[model samples]
Target: MAEAYPWQEALWQQLAGRTQHAHAYLLHGPQGIGKRALAERLMALLLCQRPKGLEACGECKSCLLLAAGSHPDNYVLEPEDTDKPIKVDQVRDLVSFIVQTAQLGGRKVVLIEPVEAMNINAANALLKSLEEPSGDTVLLLVSHQPSRLLPTIKSRCLQQACPLPGFEQSLAWLGKALPDSDEQERLELLTLAAGSPLAAVSLQAQGVREQRALVVDGVKKLLKQQSSPSQLAEAWSAVPLLLLFDWFCDWSNLVLRYQLTQDEEGLGLADMRKVVQYLAQKSSQGKVLEIQDWILVQRQKVLAKANLNRVLLLESLLVSWAMLTAQR
Candidate 1:
């Protein structure tokens, strides 16, 4: 059985209560908010031989097959490699599967996660299946960044926005998900995860807090002239490039926010609050904005899986960041 999150209870009721299901649904939201799980739950409900009031009957044959990963009526499309674009050939294969009759004589369901992973050609290939529905087939498209999707693709489906759970709700859930961690640690994790509870758990598992501590220490050293850009970049190589960029990007934003609004509360996580405030006071807004722009552009390239020289990239970023306080 799919884990039904408390935050998604109302969403589940609304979706499962529909008298007639849409041929396709576009579930769009921020990452780590359980959008994929919600889609899977819906898929199970649609395929279940006997549904028990907005939920799937776990004892049914269909449920058993799905749980066993042998369901013929369901298909999942995703990139072969993580962070890579879905190839056109994969979409072609999915098109072939969509045309086939369900072996169980029930509804055929297709789930494509992070749909924005499809390149233009692959997305175009998928459009054919979306334009012409076959039998009782239902397509569920999940996108963390729906803005990247084509307008035509967005137009063909019932677009549903999945919102983040409230802070109190997220903390309550996190208490159960991470029983060993205290409230302060969980609070830090949730803040690090940008208020996404699942992301908070994942960050905990990935030791993101440790990685963050290392980076924060490095940043403080860099500002104090105790470390070189090259040294810190190589030392932090094991940390994910995207994660590093995200932190720098966030820090830059916080610095600018504090400089403009002078809001001490806006200085982000406690790990770097002092640094953010110091940089904000030392650096000019123009210089901070410039660095922020550069970070955003490079961040996009990283997100696109560009062939970047990681060490060089990090060194350059640190060089610019170090200069932020040089003018003081």
Candidate 2:
């Protein structure tokens, strides 16, 4: 498969050793943590008729077909807009590919990315194919959140979690790609990114820096218990819900680091240690985990246009969050 992220190399070799011969697998992890890259690489290695296990022999006929995206035995299922979910038709089409005999007379490989997008009907349809994958056919499903997938779908595959590389590793990797990047800025984004290199890069480009300042300042005012909770929520009404989650995680980790290691440098400086620690220690029980679970529920409700009142939603978040912080 693709060159794995640093944290994933060991897992790749493990899979190479124990799972290369399996018929199905689920490579699941946080978004943008390189699961797709690893999946493609694994596919290449498996389809290679003469793999050294060191690497796929890239010049082989199978490799050539894969490179051209014309491999008869290799297929990738995804949720295109026209196909909001991976359809039964898509699953049925696989029968032909699995039965038509491989173009190279080799193994058949199919990958489904974000397998969670498969709606109930589509999921059940794919379940049919999973029931009886043909000889030497390999199925790989890539899901960032397997919780979004049906447990039945997960049961058919051998699941492996792709670990995210921590901040230090992400910084070093992103450094090579951003030679002129500001050290403080890079670390801030790196911490914010939670081990995803692309997320680090995307944050820099997305003006998340200023956005975070707004969020941090807003959260601090709410914690100070100065501004009316409703007013604070009104100000933050437009911030992405994910921003709240990201802030919570990063702030908690930062405060934990300060308490456990006393590393108040760079991004640590961006943190108001006492403020962070207070908020972190508080909402943790009241809202940290609960809000996280709620966010997913809210995301669906909001996205579905299920009568979400932005005012009440944001106000509830701030009020609960502030009340908890007050206990600290």
Candidate 3:
């Protein structure tokens, strides 16, 4: 394995050692969490002519070519465009690579990123290769959700489960890298990022905290009697509602904990959580889940249609909470 993230040590060992079977590997994980990094690492392990003490021998011919992105044997399958799915044509092209000769004349490492992005036809097309893979062909499929993959596809490869790191583990890793940083603030960022160290680091890089704060503060004021959807929409038009949804889910859990334990730290919700719950009780038998379910559905729509007017959609939908609270 190439030098990898700390969490990947055990996974890399299993794939590298000949003590186990050498079949296609499913390196499943969400965006970030170093899925791409791990895929590249596995590619090095398979294609490297020699390995130095469990790490890739970078000086070898295969490693050199692979490093420079000119390796002919290793194929990476991806969607035609960022928003597009892997089409039948692309998957067909992939099958051609698998059966044909390797440019490196050795192991062929094929990596399909977010394999779930493959359309139905493309997924079915890949099935034949998965079922009868040629010798020395290594498959690496990375995904955030395995369930999104076809059952046939899932059955054809070995699954390497990659989960988000724990908050403390992520925090400690960020600490060394983010030395001289504010501890409390960083931990808060780490916690908000779902314990993915990369996420925390990237969030810091992009000033996600300030963005989130702007999102929360913008929505908070809309949770009141006689709140106008138009007014709320106008205020939050520039904010991304999907990002708001992400924060709300986290905030809702905090509220749920507050409701149960009355913990003050959790009690200080950024205001949208209360709005969502307020709407939920009004429409869902005092259950916040109904509101949450609607939000989830809207999220899918938002992802599917990038042109959605987030402010209008969210303001109209979330205004229910204000009405519910006013009724109370």
Candidate 4:
């Protein structure tokens, strides 16, 4: 069974309670939320031979097949590799699958996650399936970034928006998810995850707090001229490039915000509060804006999975960051 999130109770009721299901549903929301899980749960409910009050009966043959990953009528479409675009060929295969009769004489279900991963050709191919529904087939499309999807693709499906759980609700869930972690630690994790509880759990597993501490210390040393950009870059080799870019982008935003508003409360993350304030005081707004723009471009490239020299990228970022305080 897909893990049911407490935040999604109303959403589940709304979706599962529908008298007639849509041919296609586009579930759009921020990453790390339970959009995918909700779709999975819906798929199971649709496929179950005997549903028990808007829920799948785990004892049914259909449920057993699905749990065993041998369900013939259900298909999942995703990128072959992580962060890679779904190829047109894969969409072609899915189209072929769509035209076939269900082996179980039941509904056919298709789940495509991160639907924005489909490129132009692939997305076009998928449009055919969406335009023409076959039998009792249901298509569930999941997208973390719906803005990147083609307008036509968005128009054909019933769009469902999954919102982030409330801070208190997420924190409450996190307490049970991570009983070993204290309240303060969970609070910090939730903050760092931008209020996404699942993301907070993932960050905890990845030791993001430890990595953040190291990066924070490195930045302090860099500002003090105690550590060079190249040395710090090498030291941070173990850290993920995307994560590093995210932190730097966040810091740049915080610095600019502080410079404009002079809001002590806006200096994000306690570990970097002093550093951000100091930089905001010393650094010119123009320089901060310049770095922020550069970070956004680089962050895009990272998201696109461009072939980038990690060390060089980090060095360049640090060099630009260090120059923010040079005018002082």
Candidate 2 residues 1-328, lDDT tens each? 3665787889878877764466779899887688888899888988887887657888888888888898878999887663255666776776566656666777889988878777677788777567578777988899977887888888988888988887788888889767878788788777677668877887777788787787778777777766777887677766665566556555555554544554546235445666766554454443455655555566666433356577787787667666654543
Instruction: List, residue by residue over 31-138, the lDDT tens digit for candidate 4.
Output: 888889999999999999999999999989999999999999999999999889999999999999998999999999999998999989999998978978688899
Weakest 10 consecutive residues, lDDT, candidate 2? 262-271
User: What lDDT would each prediction earn against the true structure?
Assistant: 0.93, 0.73, 0.72, 0.94
Clashes of 2: 3
| Per-residue error (Å), model 1, residue 50 | 1.2
Error of 4 at 312 (Å): 1.9
Q: What shift in Å separates residue 202 of candidate 2 from its native position after superposition? A: 3.6
The lDDT of model 2 is 0.73
Model 3's number of clashes is 0
Report the C-alpha displacement of residue 304, candidate 2, in angstroms.
9.2
How well does candidate 1 match the true structure, expressed as C-alpha RMSD? Answer: 1.0
Model 3 regions more than 4 Å off: 1-3, 225-227, 234-238, 260-287, 303-309
RMSD of 3: 3.2
For model 1, state the Cα shift of residue 270 in Å. Answer: 1.3
Stretches of candidate 4 exceeding 4 Å from the true structure = none
Pairs with backbone N, CA or C atoms under 3 Å apart (clashes), candidate 2: 1-41, 1-42, 2-41
